[model samples]
Target: MVVGDASLEIDTVVIGAGPGGYVAAIRAAQLGQSVLIVDKSEWGGVCLNRGCIPSKALISAAHQYETVQNASSMGITMENVKVDYSKVQEFKRGVVSKLTGGVAGLLKGNKVQMFKGEAMFINETEVRVFNDQEAPRYKFKNCIIATGSRPIELKPFPYGGRILSSTEALELPEIPKSLIVIGGGYIGAELSQMFAKFGTKVTIIEGADMVLPGFDKDLTQLVSKNMKKHGFEIFTKAQAQSATQTDKDVTVKFTVDGKEQEVTGDYLLVTVGRRPNTDGELGLDMIGVKMTDRGLIEVDHQGRTSIPHIYAIGDIVPGLALAHKASYEAKVAAEAIAGLPSVVDYKCIPAVCFTDPECSSVGYSEAEAKEKGYNVKVGKFAYVGNGRALSLNAPEGFVKIVADAETGLVLGGQIVGIEASNLISEVALAIENALTLEDIALTIHAHPTLGELVMEAAEVALGHPIHAIVR
Candidate 1:
């Protein structure tokens, strides 16, 4: 292992240390491949260091604070409810540190060599690991590229100072008096509502007609309604034009209904989207690997790239830029390298938005099923009719199940209410395993539980709902 040596060889090399990359590395190692996983950044990458985990931590803290502020409905009373902003950040960092440390331990326990540097392809079978002082060559029998993505920056609002990305917002020193969010996608909607819970005056400007565009409107409507009631000012069909930052505040100029308007806030958070980190020195073209114009690498069912032994997964490849999605692909890619018969399956990949009343969906939406030429029969049961939801004082949304009209097979499911994030997994399993409505309806879900909503939704789809009046 000489510093200047260019002859280090491994059975497999995984680039990036994110969820996808780390999982690929571990799985490949478990299958008896000598693996080396490298990343120039922190161990857990953006999701742990900045995106999902930290954002969720902040959201959880904000939710707790909001609960204390509004506990009168529960006949519980508290005085002088306050949030220590620094403590919240401390808690977030602690959570990240623990998980990242655990990941490192896993890699070490699995005997996966960890390297810290950037990787550029020398050829289909070779990658040069570069650092400030050394350039080491790592030759591999196989390589998996799991380099993720970064937050997309808009020219009109370059991220600096008051105009922040999610990464910066998660580490804000104090709760801003007001926040102007420029996108209403999952990241934007989730963070804006989280801040609103912490008493930040938040305004969201979205280019779409509704927030959480990836979700069905009926589901987003519940979130939109709750956000508005929580004092979030959202302007759909709005496009941000520019931002003027100052020492005290920032003024964001946007357009709505063909009229230009400005909103002043302490900070402006931009979460338009993310671009794959496939640019600048990765050398995909040098290895004759194919990628889209948008820089998303082309991969097959087993996450194999144009160069057969060279594989790609996660945000760098096509599909939803989700942590779970990348991890799923990671398993398939690693198994493929081990000569196992494994391929990626996205039929029941669940997407969850952890807002006030969490929303989750798996498999196809109602419209998606119909478009795919399935005669979809959809039925919904509201939380208002669920005993668990009423007991929890959260009866604001519904669970809808989509099934095949002829076969009664569960096609997909959507939930918009408390614990929706947790509840969607039952539906995901049903769809993934090709379970039918009767399979769920016959399952004895415990009475006075949130999970009954799934059973109830299934019953409604079967036209034999026992809880709610079938409409």
Candidate 2:
């Protein structure tokens, strides 16, 4: 094998075929630019193959299992209900395979060149992708880095068969009779609830006082209460010191408010957080890419890196580590590469937690609005007051609206109830469009639907809620 001066000419090259990378490639190709996408792993990257799809598939199955277990209370009697762990894994694998295949097909359809290899920045305008058992030199023009991120493993308890990260949690060989989750963030809360619903005695340990630290306290309190109602033991302000794994059980040693405690379980899941995947033989420093203290790539509004021609997006950059956020940023980067003006508006990005009784927020929280020095008026509508929620037998949460008291403009909205994820989009649209609270209240929402909760909340903000008795 010898090196040749064979130059591969391309208008744009994207590194790491995650949601962000593959999307940038397709958009660049659609905009009439020759594009090449390089990925060290599979085509769909972590999100499709490991993170989002796989996790959600397990959550869905767990939800179904819980629903069936509670069916008798809904006037539907059943007996001998059971969950086949292997079957669940099979279904998850099938889901991932279909999605990964879809992504591959899409890249092919767009005529985007795909390379299965690790990519390293050789220079400012070039990247070298190395395939297995091959020399490390494949050239490219204009590269976009979307290498994504990986779960943050705690120092005390490393990942093993009995100790897991979110990735391993999604691939559980068997349901543990008792599971202890470290961290009370969205990942921990969501997975803990899912396992609890599957009859696992679940305990969540968080060094913080609440499950979701950055979320509005009241909203997070509701989530915490719901988790408790589902038989989850939450140990707030608890820190894990170490973990000991044995053949049949694992023991977690921790402290809460200076008091020592221990929790034993069949497995331990560490979901503290995720770190950016910015390391490895990427030659990033050689190319002069600016990075943050946490090893995340620094990028501008248009996804341009320190080196003007190079770009970065997704978890590698600061902001929410969301797949949709990465996809949106990828579009902006691709448009910029095509010599089109593009900028990302972070105001309307929605964040949702897919736990039992989903929690979602967009624009701002009431606390965030106040912190920003805005005179805010808060409105609330409980699911207990909604006819649809009553019929569905999930009348446990509420929808809250925060508006500018002076202008009656919708500042932000948060919903904690069933199907809240879908309902939050209306709030996002309102905030993005700068619509007034009156605008949402005036819109005709269909009867016998959960979305009326949104209308009711808006009306509450206007002091004229129709569904609930006005305070």
Candidate 3:
């Protein structure tokens, strides 16, 4: 529609108004750049609308349900316990709406231009935004791609009513009487536990030898034990061949440890992994953008793609496919585009699994430290030894600290217990600051708090723990 060359000029253009795109746009605007953001779908993207926020709402509801069921032990008795799935869906929708609205307001408040359409590249310097009625084109000095990823669908089991992806699992009409989850990663483990707590007979089948593969084996063992304790079945070294759906049920066929087995359930969740959403008219190939074997765009530390002015961040790029990581990378890319030096420190990113008793880790694991040729010393303090944990009736897990023996520096930290997700932030901060084990041990932690477990673990590393008997 615009014939004049002056109409297309923009200082910075961002595609896909998810967490990364919106944040980048806002930061660029704040830095006094004329910014424009374009998105094909909702502004908040998958994480705000479907992935992180919605899933956490479901998990929170499930936890409350479990709490009600156990109220008798807390000197409280209830006549009956029940869950209204529709109300849960309403609550999740309300949350997504509020956050998405806030994002829109934020963009407007920052004076960033917003476009609602799919963006495709016409050339290295030009991008075309296609809307239903008309196609508008804009040329920018710099562009950032924040197109996120989608749930990976297994070839053996296509997504349907019986065979569901994580998205569909978040919107269950009713909790299935029995559920089978394929994939032993964090997604599978967390969702399986949530459903089990909601009274669904849950089972997990993983091709790997353990659930939460790539995690510290000890932590994985604790997760497995907790699942078993909650009456969930877990099968490792198992590969699902196919799933057959019928009117009454769905039967999953898999081989476990060279033994053929079949499990039937009301639903099957496919959470093997997620793939980048890089296709759909983006014109990436025309711009000479290099992509990995998995179709993820290759970007530098500052999020610049092969094309000098074009950058990519979030799930469209690499590293951990988490929302917060995306946001951090967006800032770096924005700052770099504004002719400022910005670098993303990948080592400080934290990963958390929101199971009943959460699991979280940051930086190097003990095995990773050893593989890197470091003389690692580990210290572990169980929740059973923590007064707060015992009072809360969730003393099943422990915190493990891995540090350099020579320098007493904290290399990594892992925790598997209640509120472990929030607890891992301190470890991340310590790792980012290069804090030593001795430093953490010397710091005084408040009494009757779960956080004291971190200090206790550091004390154990120093061979002098107060709460538990030192061996």
lDDT tens digits, residues 1-471, model 3?
665443478899999888899999999999899999998789899988878888888888888888888888879899767888889889888888999999999999999999988888889888887788767778789999999999998778999868999989998888889999999898888888888888889889988889998777877788788789888888888889988999878999999877889999999999999999897778898878999998999988899999989999999887888899999999999999988999888987888988767889998999899999999999899999999998887888999999999999898999999999999998898998999998898888899999999999999988888887876
lDDT by residue (tens digit), candidate 1, 1-471: 446555688999999999999999999999999999999998988898989999998899988888788789999999988889999999999999999999999999999999888999888888888788778898899999999999999998999989899889988999998999999999998999988988899999999899999899999998999988988898999978888888999998889998999999999999999999998898888878888989999989999998899999999998889999999999999999999999988888999999878889999899999999999898799999988899888989999999999999999999999999999999999988899999999999998899999999898988888777765
What lDDT score goes with residue 156 in model 3? 85
Residue-level lDDT of model 2, residues 1-471, one tens digit each, is 325645566788899899999999999999998888988899989999988888888889988898788788789999999898999999999999999999999999999988888887777776677786653454555778999999998778899868999988888788889999999888988888888888899899998888988777767877888788878888988889999989888999999989999989999999988998898898898878999999988899999999888999999999999999999999999999889999988998999988777889998899889999999988899999989898888988899999999998888989988898899999999998999998998899999899999999999888887777774
Full ranking by lDDT: 1, 3, 2
Superposition TM-score, candidate 3 onto the true structure: 0.96
TM for every model, in the order presented, reads 0.98, 0.97, 0.96
Query: Which clashing pairs does model 1 show?
Result: none
**Where is the poorest 10-residue window by lDDT in model 1?**
1-10
Residue-level lDDT for 265 in candidate 2:
96
Where model 1 places Cα greater than 4 Å from the true spot, the runs are none
- Find the candidate with the highest lDDT and give its number: 1
Give the root-mean-square deviation of each candidate in angstroms.
1.1, 1.6, 1.7
CA deviation > 4 Å runs, candidate 3: 1-7
Best model per TM-score: 1
